[model samples]
Target: MYDFNFHKPATLDAALETFESSDDGQFMAGGQTMIPVMKQRLAMPSDVIDLGAIDDLNGISAGNGLVSIGAMTPHAAVAASGTVQDAIPALAELAGRIGDPHVRNRGTIGGSIANSDPAADYPAAVLGLKAIVRTNRREVAADDFFTDLFETALDEGELIIAVDFPIADAAAYEKFENPASRFALVGVMVCRTGSDVRVAVTGAGPCAFRVTEMEQALAANFNPEALKGISIGADDLNSDIHASAEYRAHLVGVMAGRAVGRMA
Candidate 1:
């Protein structure tokens, strides 16, 4: 890593102040992606503001038919939380399956959402579940939160406070993971709340996106067979060494089918 000033602010206000004071300052959440980028000299921030000491950014609560997860809450905590498991077992399962034990223990939900990795699992869940992202300044719906690959609606010096996920009638997440990184090659989240059916797919495109056709089919008939003839176009999908765009598109259908099957 290049030389930089590191500041561990004990309060959120202090962190925000430090972040705003410098144009080249960046927030350090779990240091998962940011650290790697720094080591590769991809980012050379003048100041690194560590949010680890901010006590207000860690907690999990369930009430009013909604589950609120703090930005700083670790994936392991989210996976193991009684409230999360009781309210949304599939979400908990998804969290549990993220990366390895160490990654789960260190990576934060806010970090994941902010990074907005094209193949990240949480984006699918957020979009499918219709969760609201709470930031220091405002609340952004899941649809508006993600902009594009490695990008979000978050502005400079703005920090995510928490995420509010409303409980759904039935939901599940299924992903075809890369063996090495455990990142999804194609992940799908299916949610049925009342009469509304939402289908979100990740790892198959530039960003997590809703499958309107699949959602319409599921709304009519919530069954794995509903996705039998449906196929995703491969033109916009990520094509890497591990998998081709066509393969990822194929997995989108397969994973969506599995998710619907699991829900059923």
Candidate 2:
């Protein structure tokens, strides 16, 4: 962890201005990922522009069968939001299951997805539900937002303003978690949002991905039974000390079935 200049601008313009002025500046959203990385000396930015004080970055609104959440809105706020619970209980449950209470209290949706942690919960929800990622300059579709491991489609200076999630006809998330850390060993989010069925998987690959075959099966018949005998080859999936690629590949099917079962 290196010493760095800290800036908490009250406006988006001010934050962007401060961020652009520095050669090595980074945005601090909730500081959940940045703080830990800083402590471990993994990141040494010259300036840290805090987005917390920007009022526009901290609220939740729901309308027209879609729920919009501010970038800086905390995970706890999202989990406890009455509007969220009613509009998308599965999303609320997913938010509640993120890390522990402290992490949820401080970690944010924007920060989580921006970091693009391969095993993160929000990416599944974002992609599975086909959300719109509104940024300072443009809107990115969820399908295009996650580009690779720890990567996104956002430009270096772009800041996410908010995310718009379209309500689904049915949705559920299931994860085989590492008990100690609670990070997903393999997580799956199953959703049928109108005519399309989407199955987004996380923790078993470099980044969360969709299984279109399963999506098609589930789309044809919205039931866990529809997923029977389907498989995802392990060639590109993750193989780690926690779980082997084969095991992870297996868990993907199991979790997807469980997710669909909940919604079935």
Candidate 3:
């Protein structure tokens, strides 16, 4: 790894100050993506501000009809939370299926969403649930937060404080995962609450995005039958050695159907 100064601030304000005071700095939540990149000499920030010491950035709570998850809370914690299971079992299930056990223990939800990896699981849930991303300076709706592949709306020195997800009436997630890495080849989150229906898809494209047609169909029928002839074109999907864009496009519909089929 490149030589760099490290700071573990006890509070968010201190961390922000320390990071901004440096010529170049990056926030470290769980260090899942940043650490690996640094080790490869792909990133050489002047300072690394660790958010782990900030007491307020880790926990889970429910209030005002939403589940608030602290930015620094690890995936394992989310997967095991009874509150998450009771309020949104689909969210917890998605957390449990991210990567492997070791990755889950070290990866944080804030870090994942902030990095905005297209194949990452959190974005699908965030967009599907229409969650609000609470940052240091502002609140960004999930629809506007993820701008593109490996990118987000978070500004320079901006840090995610927490994410608030509304509890849907019924929801489910299904992923077609790469066996070795467990990253989604194509994942779908289907949710229905009152008159609102949402279908968020990931892994097939450059970023996680909602399928409005699928949402409308599901809103009308709210079942696998609703998606009988629906399919997204492969023209804009990611084609990697793991799977062709055509295959990924096909999996999107399959996964969405499965997710809706699994809803209780």
- 22-98 per-residue lDDT for model 3 (tens digits): 99999998888999999988888999999999989999999788999999999999999999999999999999999
What is the Å distance of residue 162 in model 1 from its true position? Answer: 0.3
List the candidate 3 regions with Cα displacement exceeding 4 Å.
Answer: none
Candidate 3: lDDT of 89?
A: 97
Q: Which stretches of candidate 2 lie over 4 Å from their true place?
A: none
> Please, what are the lDDT tens digits per residue for candidate 2 over residues 93-211?
99999999999999999999999998888999999999999999999999999988999999998999999999999899999998887789899999887778999998988888999
lDDT by residue for model 1 (18-101), tens: 988876999999999999999999999999999999889999999999999999999999999999999999899999989999
Ranking by lDDT: 1, 3, 2
Against the unseen true structure, what C-alpha lDDT does each candidate score?
A: 0.93, 0.92, 0.93
How many Å off is the CA of 154 in candidate 1?
A: 0.8
Model 1 misplaced stretches (Cα beyond 4 Å): none
Question: Which candidate, 1 or 3, has the higher lDDT?
Answer: 1
Q: Clashing residue pairs, candidate 1?
A: none
Cα RMSD for predicted model 2: 1.0
- Output the TM-score of candidate 2: 0.98
